[model samples]
Target: MKTIFTAIFIILLLSACTKTLDIKLRSTEPKIVIQGNVTNSGGPYYIRINKTVDFDANNEYPPVVNATVSVLDSNTRRVDYYKYTGVNGYYISNNLFGQVGHTYKLTVTVDGETYTASSTMPNFVGINQLDFVQTKILNKTRILPQVTFTDPAYEKNYYVFSLAVNNVTYKAFYAVDDRLTDGNEMVQQLYMDSSYIQKRDFVTVILSSVDKNVYNYFNVLQANSGASPTTPSNPPSNISNGAYGYFGAEAVSMVSQSF
Candidate 1:
């Protein structure tokens, strides 16, 4: 009788353990990984998706095939969708052309998981004017370039600035000091200051991009959103007759001094 009771207890314990393991396995959800790359040519862009990684696994990323891909332009006019190539997780747009003045919107869907990202085409903010000025920094030289903009502003302001050594554009670095100053008040000066001596002949100050809405925000507060007092292209260009223009397309020019 004692041996039979012991055997029965062991069997019950094992069955309970199995039930607990099944419950734990059913509670977990799958993860996803997203990867992206852009090209320098006029058009053609691609994106890939895969299963998310786990810390315990050696190769966490698993290719996600048959996912959907879509791209939207700045004007919200041009939108392109890519078809999956059927090789375990790849998508491509053959006719998509990325323009400097345009912005892009991307969406990816796989295994009931969806992800989205949007970015504006970093326009080459043409250097309207630049000149070197004497500075107190002993080891460094200062190149003061006056930047002007011909584009209009938008809402939800933001900006990203970059600097590059002219010939080798590959190693472009963010203009640490690059920025936009308050358009409202007249500023004493706006230019970048750095430890690196910018060779006027070899270096170029670049304003990669700026938020149109933020640009207009600065102007609206300062009461300069007009072409009369300033030039026709001055502040408030992002506004169309008092309402926010283009739903998402806003442009701003960063003056060198503002940086």
Candidate 2:
């Protein structure tokens, strides 16, 4: 069943590890960062707007208020206007429910400049089960979460998995595709740094069926994960017109298990 993961915030926190750049950033015009999502769970979808801080500045993200934002549902040909709550850069949608196989378009105007993006909600794929395995590396034991699901052979699918340990979130984004094992029952393990998962910790995994741009976004981050922090390189955002962030649609499934 579809349950238990928050939107906008997850996308913000999913890229949490990218903030650890070692070199101090030069002062420049702060770009508009938009974290928007349309989900199948229905009503009151939220989007967050914020500005980035300097590399060595405090970790707080300042909200960008009074922006005009709207989302268009292609299937219904209707638009939902979002009004800012004037806190946390959040905007609330009025009367938009996510549907599988429908495309969504997001438009945001800040300071007379507008940015646009599009994403489609794919069919839902639930988790068959969750399992755990232990592996030794460099003389240390690591706990890995195994996620099992059957991929549909008729079409291509891309997914992103979010992990949390004892209610504490992990710092990286995990993404996978069904290129090699399409139509088969696939068991995928999430591998992190040594000893990250400990015994008796309650682990939560959220599997998201996302569009290609969203998959490519996280895939780029996963690939450049080992780059030097001083010269960090992130993939260009899916949003257009010079904004930095993503507007996505997610069909999700989640499960929690004890480690």
Candidate 3:
């Protein structure tokens, strides 16, 4: 009986000595995030500028309004101004369209600080054909869409692909470089996690020719997408002046099919 009481008292003393650990996480200063893209497909390109928030805060990123945004064509020396649309953080271009082989520069000024990035529009490549096939992924049969295209010989090329199902766009980090398959006819399969595509669904695929910096940005972004937010590192950004995100000028092509 004395040994049992001693054991119980020792257990109670250990429990009383245990204290909860309250880890205080320090929040970093907010930085601007800019996501902008210009493609050969059409005009009215948009640039979104927002400020990063604390890790514990909501996902809403406050927009940075009243900023001066412009796009400059290096070859033609023409500057296109963007106007804030009061919708989200979007700024739309008035009369600028991306052209292949021309370099474009993005400039944004907010709170007396300026951020800049440059990207050249790459040449367009066509998708030869697209088809759907049944394949087993993760022990489940799925109808996957595949695309076939011929990479140009003796040239370095990078591509970004996006899919739309039934008019709803699904953006994935499906970026590829033709380093291994250079000058070869390649058939690439497209995949997504949700498996929402079905038979007779309207599908649209967009293929964009991107520059090296943009390709690297997407490569890191895809790699880090699955990681925990507590990780210290961040994805590479092309925008300078302590900003996050990327600015890309791409030559784009699209094809649609009813699966």
Candidate 4:
């Protein structure tokens, strides 16, 4: 999925060189944004709880403290809990799980209401190679990262790849599913603004194998935030109790490239 900022940049730059947009965001009642994830890479994984801010307000997310959170392993029937770091709405898990085919359930109780989500860790898929290839976007030549991986056959698979430059992760995530090209040697190109890519910059690409629910959440989010995004609508959340954000369990493969 292209990031909102980078996608907007491509849309404007490729279309008319420059354009103006006037978006008026309406104020809505504050809702909590609870996001958490578990990876096969291991833990103490993180969970963040925050409330959405007003449109006219400063760009700040108010943290939701005093919430009780837990991650339970369905396979082992053991429970792993979390502790708030006392800032930034961050909660770190203890005794995390990394086993495949295990379902994990996350429970967060806030203000006497409980919100929950569950995810199962899929089988692992590793990146074969990483390459920086030149491509054209709307007649503009741009160098983008290409990842090579062998897609597994027979099962439905979904993926999300995220990029980080010099240890700073970009907010834009790329999500794709094995629809027509299942069981093929796939070369997926990551499209983003690469103007700041300098010589010898460390680049990291993480490919996540996610469940269908988690995939849908990010797929709709990616769609709504694409170039020439349509009327804004909320992305589907897997969390119960009407919360915003997602709780995901992913089996990930990571590859890094320099220069």
Output the lDDT of residue 92, model 1. Answer: 58
**Better TM-score candidate (3, 4):** 3
- After superposition, the stretches of candidate 3 with alpha carbons farther than 4 Å from their true spots are 1-27
lDDT of 1 by residue, 1-259 (tens): 5664344333222211000000001112345444343322333344555553333344445567778777777574777887765543446566766555676666666656556655565443343554445554556545443334333233222332333333222121222112343222111222343433344444434343444443343334233322243222322323222221111222223223222
lDDT of each: 0.39, 0.76, 0.75, 0.75
Q: Write the per-residue lDDT of candidate 2 for residues 187-232, one digit (tens) a residue.
A: 8888876447777998877788899898887787776676765555
The C-alpha stretches of model 2 lying farther than 4 A from their native spots are 1-27, 54-59
Best by TM-score: 3
For model 4, residues 102-163, the per-residue Cα lDDT tens digits are 99899999999899999998888899999998777778776677899988999889987777
Q: What is the lDDT of residue 151 in candidate 3?
A: 91
Error of 1 at 21 (Å): 35
TM-score-based ranking, best first?
3, 4, 2, 1
Q: On a 0 to 100 scale, what is the lDDT of residue 76 in model 3? A: 94
User: Which tens-of-lDDT digit does each residue in 1-259 have in candidate 3?
Assistant: 5664344333212211111111112237778888877777666677878887776776577888889999999999999999986766767789996789999999999999999999998888988998887888778888877888989999999987777777555546478999999999988888877665687998877777899998887776666556665663565779998888889888776778998
